[model samples]
Target: MLLQSPWPSRVNDSSTKATHVFITDFLKEKGVSTLDVLVNNAAIGSECFKETFDVNVVGTVAVTWANVNRVLR
Candidate 1:
């Protein structure tokens, strides 16, 4: 379920959460136990100030720490 968007391929907080969980779940399902790279790729612009924080700051924080707590060794 790929999204076709002119908005470009930007990762957000929700996506970060989803991605981290997706990888973790995939590893669990396959009985694999190792995590090397966890990319927190989310972005925003100056034009949308509020949205920037909502997406970039808050979203990143929530996702990053949640991922760490859930996936870290």
Candidate 2:
């Protein structure tokens, strides 16, 4: 139950940062909650080294970090 996911944007897209911020902010505004298991489902296969790491690894970590300690009690 992550707030934001960077998988929507193409791999290596810088806009993912903004999306993460937006989702976190949205959750805060509405008093949303935090998440436990972050399923890294959305990933793109690549023929190069950079794309594979950026999408599957970097993006997944970035999105998951945004949800940490964001739960409102």
Candidate 2: give the clashing pairs.
Answer: none
**For candidate 2, lDDT tens digit of each residue in 1-73?**
3435753433333588875775566567658666444434355344554677688889998977887677432
Model 2, stretches more than 4 Å misplaced?
A: 1-47, 70-73
Off by over 4 Å in 1: 1-47
TM-score of each model, paired residue for residue = 0.30, 0.29
Cα lDDT, all candidates: 0.64, 0.59
Residue 24, model 2: Cα distance from true site in angstroms: 47
The superposed Cα distance between candidate 2 and the true structure at residue 13, in angstroms, equals 33
lDDT of 2 at 49: 48
Model 1 collision count: 0
CA displacement after TM-score superposition, residue 70 of candidate 2 (Å) = 4.6
